[model samples]
Target: MTRIPDQPKRLRIVPISKLAAAPKWQLETLRALREPVFFWFTAGQGRITLGGSTRGVHPHNAIYIPPGTMYGFQAMTRTQGVALHMGDPTGLDLPETPLHLRLRDGSQHAEVAQIMDAIQRELEGAKDFAERAARHQIGLLAIWLERQRSSAGDDSPRGLSSTNANERLTARYSTLLERSFGSALNVGDYAQALGVTPTHLTRACRASCGRTALQLVQERRLYEARRLLSETDVPVQDIARNLGFSTPGYFSRAFSAHTGTAPSLYRKARGA
Candidate 1:
């Protein structure tokens, strides 16, 4: 028998509705990804918190998030969009920061839609060199994003600015949390590392994203626990230990409180 090699993971588009089908915590909780993502909304409205800043989004809004940035959103209405997951943008000329552009001009919207359509077709087809063709289309999309950012000039999203002290501090805290969420570090320990008192750190977090520092830390840990439970067959007790919970009972209680389901039950429900 001839051996077949596994196919490399290619970029793909996910409809916003399908993404919403996931558990609410998976979408609404503060978490970070290892790959960059771009969201293009065609209808409805929502408020998204990215890098400790919350902003409203509506139809024809394009939001770009770089890898390792914490973000979450609440869809106030029926949201409609597609998310492009760009895996390992090692050499792409993409933005290093987040962008939320409201493309008001109909022409601009059409241009983006066209590029996305091309990429989608290439991904769905089995034609020769489809991945390469899709990558070229991604390049075009990157250029479009650059042009939109330049044209927006001063009218760009305010959340992208790092001038605010609270936002900057919260951003740093988010980075540290992403790196060390698995450790047994509490909010006080993190505050000490950042050279701020726990009270001041919580205040800054609330001012920036409406969540206290402790809440952010717990949310990130729960997010990881949920991911591990749903995606792996690892033992529940082992998961608790790996996530820094002092005891399996405590971990189960925390998971149930946040998700309304115990960790073992959650994994069974996910068919893992």
Candidate 2:
């Protein structure tokens, strides 16, 4: 299946060890993004914290993390892997949460690695229409993963087969927040929309994501604020209004409190 081209065409392939070379603060920060991440772990082992659950990852584990989920991973050993960062402005057919698949079969593992290599080559070769070629490769990878998920049947990954209440509620909350954050939705409003009490929502959020319900909502907003400040030419006041803040002052206070930088300063620093 061909991926629709309506979404932004940004593709990056990088090794996992780059994290070790990056600044300490960048590695320590948890990220919520508007893109899905595909990773193939070829060496080393570590744990992945995905929303409400943590899973150990080793060689041959492929992770498909959906947009809007909070995720972070660490490599305990000298890790090497291929990671694909894909933007999704059109709400493409990405997973709703994280999928950790262990390719116990050597052939399956090699096939995935080969596809990733192809994506990397297409990206680095810098040929004409390289972006188009990379997107096609990603679409193929997505289809292959879907096939594996279908064949897993009853013994699929716990993240897929299990329906833990806290996990379910937290996933729903994340999805809702991804769509409703700009509308000024609060914890109570979110809880009501999800048909649960604010207290229960907070409890579930903490149990699953290590964050309170209100914190999750605020964090999403702050992430958007930071993203806009770093990537767009929109005025600070305009961004504030669009993100549901009553005034630029309130937005600046919140942004500074959460991000330690005012909007204008962040934009300038990031060269937006």
Candidate 3:
């Protein structure tokens, strides 16, 4: 019998180490997710770039990223934590903007850990009402986030402020890239749409994320390519068309160059 491709889960708790085990580009590349993510770090330290600003993240740090925000981080150390992917925020009391909290209170740390563990149990148990249980746990986690943000006051990560002109431009560019990556828009097109020259855009992106505008676009497209190849049974040709590649052959070459493996082989190795 053939296996059905697994759909992306809405509610889940993933270990930080497991997430780090994937190819670095998947997480370290500047990109956005469609769902809100709450990362609770229990050990290790590294720098995380969010909203075009980079900052140091240590143990007990909690980062909340709303959907459509551009963010990435370095798995420089033996990072140990749990990442909670909250499906839909329709009625949840989550913050509208990104938040990076350096949690110093022991009780606060324990509270987050417990909430994550509870969500994990509900998801893994496969018991009756597990979905409902998980949702409730997520609600509680949102409340915890609110209280922590309120008490922390000015929960901004340091380094570069999002208001910096270059950072702001980079943030806008990233947002547009995330929304239109599947289209055939090139870096020049993006720069024109943003009322800036291609060179300026590239410079801003480099300053903000150490990547040129073209590199950012290529990475974002390839990231989605890998996701489709590893997570779904979509044909390589379809994936190419969907991602705006002119032809399957061109897509294969690009994918091979980026991953050092053909799309088919990548999927087969993953047993997708």
Taking all chains together, each candidate's TM-score versus the true structure is 0.90, 0.79, 0.86
Candidates sorted by TM-score, best first: 1, 3, 2
In model 3, pairs of residues that clash are: none
Candidate 2, poorest ten consecutive residues by summed lDDT = 1-10
What is the lDDT of every predicted structure here?
0.83, 0.74, 0.82
lDDT of 2 by residue, 138-202 (tens): 88888887877767757556335564799788877877776777777789999999999999999
Instruction: Give the C-alpha lDDT of model 2.
Output: 0.74
**Top candidate (TM-score):** 1
> CA lDDT of 48 in candidate 3?
84
In the range 1-272, model 3's lDDT, one tens digit per residue, is 22323325387788988887777887688778778999988888888878766678898888899888888888655889989888876777777778788777788778888888898999999999997888888889888877766665332442123358888898889889988888899999999999999999999988977889999888888888888788888888888887789999999999999899999999999998
Residue 7 accuracy (lDDT) in model 2: 25
In model 3, where do residues sit more than 4 Å from their true spots? 1-7, 124-127, 151-163
Candidate 1: worst-modelled 10 consecutive residues by lDDT = 1-10
Please report the TM-score between candidate 2 and the true structure.
0.79
- Cα deviation of 139, candidate 2, in Å: 4.0
Runs with alpha carbons beyond 4 Å of true place in candidate 2: 1-8, 19-36, 44-52, 66-79, 86-98, 127-136, 153-159
Report the C-alpha displacement of residue 44, candidate 2, in angstroms.
4.5
